[model samples]
Target: LSEIYPRNLMRKTAKMGGLPSPSEFVKLVNSSASQGDIQIDHVEVIAPIYEKWPPDSHTRIFLDSSNKTDEPVYAREVLSNFLSRAWRHHATDAEIDQKLALFAKIRPKCDDFQEAMVEVLATVLSSPKFLYLVPPGRAKRSGKSGDGNRLAAWELATRLSVFLWCSTPDDELLELSARGRLNDRDVLVSQVKRMLADPRSRRFSRHFVRQWLGMQLLDFLQVDRKAFRQFNPSLKEAMQEEPIAFFDEVLKHNHSVLDFIHADYTMTNERLARHYGLKDVYGNDFRRVELDSTHRRGGLLTQAGLLAMNSDGK
Candidate 1:
């Protein structure tokens, strides 16, 4: 929708039937279409878009320092700060010293500080500190263990974030864990709620549903394309998206898990509705459409994508 028609609807209307052609636009200009010019002397680009100067990104690299000119000191400070976030553990002074030693060795060989640090950062990324999230012995989320060992708060927070968001813990989650509140049932519940509300949680639905349902099998199996008249590459993509979309809808609405097998409404879009002989829905956007018994469709089994994947390719 953002592609076809943006929210602002700038110089566009449903009746105009898409952007005016170059010649049509020129004709409108001559015919005196509403003429207005608002001169913009400057613009303030926002964060998560354009970083503020001395940009947060710049500050992230070049932190405040008592000995700013002491490159080695500042480099040590930066590396320690980065290790805490990337490794999800505090960097011991010894560890930082070792890394700074490498940085010092590399810095003199490079054109500049930034270029030299890239090699150090690459080394950190390849290290186990970045490569793996090793759950300690008996530090699982359930906390029920014969040995009675429990996960640290940060450990639990990292586990939750990775499982749900398939990413590192955000600031709030890490803070909660640092405070040793993550394991508390009430705090855990609140954090779970917050994580669910986060957009990142969508990753959980995509990955979990795809794997659990074996949706990737769709890619390997050749559909009987000729027999299925409407099953082209674009439609094939839509078919693959259907189950994931359905799963996402069920998750977002907190609908019953049984909806995978039986739901009154199935998600469809212009392409899917046409393929399903579903009426009225128009546009690329997928949406829920109410289905009755006559449609002979409600669940995963009846989907064209799955059915084709299951077919003996003709």
Candidate 2:
């Protein structure tokens, strides 16, 4: 059993047909009567959930601080740290003070400091500073600029991160923006290059490719096993990943966009390679393989997932 974060897909696989599962789940003493994958007759045994004592999740939230017990003392420290991160490192003293006051007011009504602090933390999370990217109005350019919707250094960093990484700016980007020189053309280019080079940019590839190609239809389309006997659930996943992986490769190498329509290679694993009548490629991991005219596979149109999704299964 793989300890993967995405819901342990191996556990729910149907053993009868080597195809995608479409069965509905029901909880009973003998729900899966004849199934080999799930034994409903036998007591369902789960793998050991926790590998470490006190667990990482608990230690992460309930941090190892000196004032773990003293809510009055630790509330300021915790709130400040949490607000800074939640606000994408743009947390201000005023915001911190407001949260601390809320915590103090709620402390007496709640059973303990943790419970009271939680209420304050919720408010901080819900605040406009945390939710909205209210750009800092820094239109004071040296040359000549009036009302140039120019995002402040920190604000630009936030948008850049969210645009590329789908998350908050890292410490490096935030520090660069705070220096106020991030607006400089050369500096901005360097920062953009840095962000595009980071592993987090994979989020952009995934998000962009999915939206660009209308991949959501794949989720609802049922594969016809009678026609596509080789098609399995894992192959279905690989299909969705192909376009994203291809896009990521192009972005990483700064390849021409024309490659999208006519590439020299395609992303594939053993599952996909086999489906495409490719030889020698093996393993579940996806990688680009050189393509030739004889292969009859070139670009996104030839991708198994797209072909399958568009087909009537005849």
Candidate 3:
């Protein structure tokens, strides 16, 4: 039953009631359900399962299943793999050993192996190498000759991922980077197209539009409730999303840039459609809809959010 518990509800409970131990949390849930507080008809409670104990098949071969004899070997492998992803490059033997030493020092104080490993992993994540887009002195200090003048393949991949996905490079991008092919003209263009086709590229649209159009103002801008009784949070959220969705629509279709100034169609969802007094728009998801002159709306200039956020709420 605990496995089936919604993650968000657990987070909410933690926030409101304070964090509880696993047993205490299950007890709280059971007590709530039994008292008709949770409103559940059925619950089959089961003991907690430790999914990480056996380790998955990809990782299993690195560990000695019978005992802790191969723990150091396993730890080094884990750190190396983690560094490759987090640092966006291969970890040197020295780097791997440094983390392994940290794990060894922390293991004696922690209750279990997993806890100490988690601390080591956290240290890796918090590293300057992991935090910065391209860590200072890396290009100039790298072992590769002539690297000081230009970005490394791995650094280029990281920048491209940050530009398109707003996240770390996936396996494919990392592999291309590792092979030093990410900078090739044809390969770079192909990867760009591939990245744009990915769902993660939506982050590019959302973030680029927000920054370029100064939509961050809308985030903290307070709409006066008394002055605009019909302006609710849902409508405000729809307004905030409109321009990004509108930009994405034009970009995906390769429409003319002029559409931004005066498009015959606009992206909208139910809440925003209602605000614009349009009919037949359903659901929260934004989609392109043909516009008519009766709506008296078109382009980024006509977005409700841009107008409202720019106002003093009078």
Candidate 4:
């Protein structure tokens, strides 16, 4: 599920700490954990080792057979085979063919075929078709299995992933779609509940309050520095986080929405509690503190987030 980055690839190379043969490159790219093993599925040309072959080195060019003086006829063949294996299920023959043709078109202009294939690989990575999960074919009145109109398995998986995890489908979800088993309501509900239970669902609170109070525009508010010297960067960060934490607690604990107005408890870390004149609270952990009538800190209005956002001066 993780995107492969050049830095991580380089780190793996360093960990190996030796001149890498083509087999080593194959091992790195085709490793199960990296993008999953491709060897069992098909033969693949591992992307060129950048350090072993400079971007346009003569040796690299010679490998692709574009040098005409000395070239490997199997270079393009190997690259095409590798790409097809790596992207086996996701890309169609037409798509792979298009990419191979791109390699052919660029090979004459470039010094080496490996370099040309690098350009092709870069294009494949950046292509919208590769990066985005697009459902096959145009929208139709009826879907597979004679449903008059319903979301396809892939589309449903995408919606469920974004709603629950706020991200794209992982291998499990994608595999479910590939097997055509993501349509059950019970299964979808289970996934939704699981995702909501995850810590990342705190995003819900952040998005809700930001829109509810229209505080988004306040980013441009110019504070009078001399008037509000107490408002430091740490205080501002604490203010934003306090309400978000509180709202998350409410959701996690299934507390009534009315608690937002009537509950005496507020969340605060040491720094925030000190700013709010709450005594004896220490450390950077948020804990709920019950408010007394004398404190007048019953709800979010008394919280640092809203207070800071609403404060004009003094």
Candidate 5:
């Protein structure tokens, strides 16, 4: 029964138009898992499981019941680090002391130091300082002059990272903000190029294209099997990814945005190529493919996914 599972899975996948046949799926899996194709370029451990913290570390000071003298220092260090990383800027002494007071109040009721600290950190995470992109020196809204006119270095870094990567700024970005170099136009352009080259920028492309083209329509799309026996779930999935990949390609090559309306090429995986009646392309990976007159396909206007999704499920 276990041996039949892989074959059965492949049959279902093939029927959904993911694979040409069960044999092809097996071949693709075998090729991928083959030892000859495997390579280990490098390995770097970012964090290691530690039974104990090193000397003078905040965790060590906090955990040692005998080190009551250093407990305030430990709290300050921990809270300050949390503020920098989570709130994306330095915390004032008052802010750190407030969190420390919370930790002290909760300490007696909690089972352990870790549990007390967890509650303190939860408040930090919940604070608007961490949750929202409120520019520095602009925390309070004011009708008076010069209150929220400009962004601080840290605020700009957070905005740039969130806009381009859909994530918080990395150490490099934060370091630049610390040194006050990120605001320089040349430095900013270089950082933008570096970020776009990084794979994280794919999130930007996917998110922007989805919102711009209203791709949410595809998510609720329901097709009638009897009306279009040739249409399969795999094809629909490929259709959804096509626009995102196409947008990424144009951004990658610095192509004019006009190409989206009428280009001689489109992005496709094997499933989508077959749906469009294009020949010879294979594999589940999408790539740029040149389209000809016979293909009668070009841009977002003629893409089957967009057409089917907007239909009445006929």
Candidate 6:
């Protein structure tokens, strides 16, 4: 009866209470269950079962498990769905038919319908029509005749959102463009403010700071061991994170940009804190610490990262 105790009961107990010794707990539970004082209706099994299939066999068994046969019309529907999602617009009847014809040509060579669909998806993803941002209809001049073409409202909105927010246009921006109101100053400004307020705007600050400080190459930069024996891989990683974390706090909390030049508070982890001669710091996590003028660590130039990078080889 002790051997009959369900494995899942032991697992659940361990998960909920935190297992210190799993084997001992399991043995104890099994012994108690086998004493016949407690009734055991069922034993829970937790181990996963493995199945072996042929190397060439399609793992997606559901693809042809249905008695329903593949229809040409269904292929067209699949193509339409792909185009709609890829282009973010409704597909024309001619476009759908053309894709269906391509699918029909490729379907016979593939053993399964899913394999045929994969081929179509690959083609669609690779096509210039899906990859490039193209304006609908013919190119027309804006104000100058030689300028070629002006960006459509949707294109302009998408470009602006990607530039400022580093993401796709949100529903509000998309709707404004769809309604031909995206270019309106008040509407555009409102959308801009909303976008900037979103969490995605942190990407802009991260990108800007990384590029401005040349910290983007920190990963590839080689550290001199003779000059700074303390600068190991972990120390280098902490150094990279310290500046970014400090900048993020300043931007998120609306601190002045000048604070970066001479902020009283800066980020430091245990390794970095010790490296810079900071006291009362422990653990691997980084935290902002206020520095007094007497400490003489007022700016980023005084930080260990910059000092290590600029030091002469010993």
Question: Which has the greatest lDDT?
Answer: 3
- Clash totals, every prediction: 0, 0, 0, 4, 0, 1
Q: Taking the tens digit of each residue's C-alpha lDDT, what string does model 5 give over 1-314?
A: 01222333434331112434443322222222111343447544343335555534445324444544576676677777777777877676888889999889887876665667767888888988778888566664345653333236778889899999988788899889887888899999999999999999999999999999899999898889998887766677788999999999999889877888888999998888887888888877889999887765677788887787788887
- Pick the TM-score winner: 3
* lDDT computed for candidate 1: 0.73
Q: Which pairs in model 1 have colliding backbones?
A: none
Candidate order by TM-score, decreasing, is 3, 1, 2, 5, 4, 6
Model 3 clash tally, residue pairs: 0
Per-candidate Cα lDDT values, in order, are 0.73, 0.72, 0.76, 0.60, 0.75, 0.64
TM-score of 5: 0.70
Output the lDDT of residue 102, model 1: 90
| Model 5: residues with Cα > 4 Å off, grouped in runs | 1-72, 108-115, 140-151
The lDDT ranking, best first, is 3, 5, 1, 2, 6, 4
lDDT of 2 at 144: 37
* Candidate 2 global Cα RMSD: 9.4
lDDT tens string, model 4, 170-273?
A: 56776776676667777776766766787766766677767777665445455677987766555666677777778778877888898788677888876678
Worst 10 residues of 3 by lDDT: 28-37
Q: What is the C-alpha RMSD of each candidate to the true structure, in Å?
A: 12.1, 9.4, 7.1, 14.0, 11.5, 14.2
- Of 2 and 6, which scores higher on lDDT? 2
Using lDDT as the measure, name the better of candidate 3 and candidate 4.
3
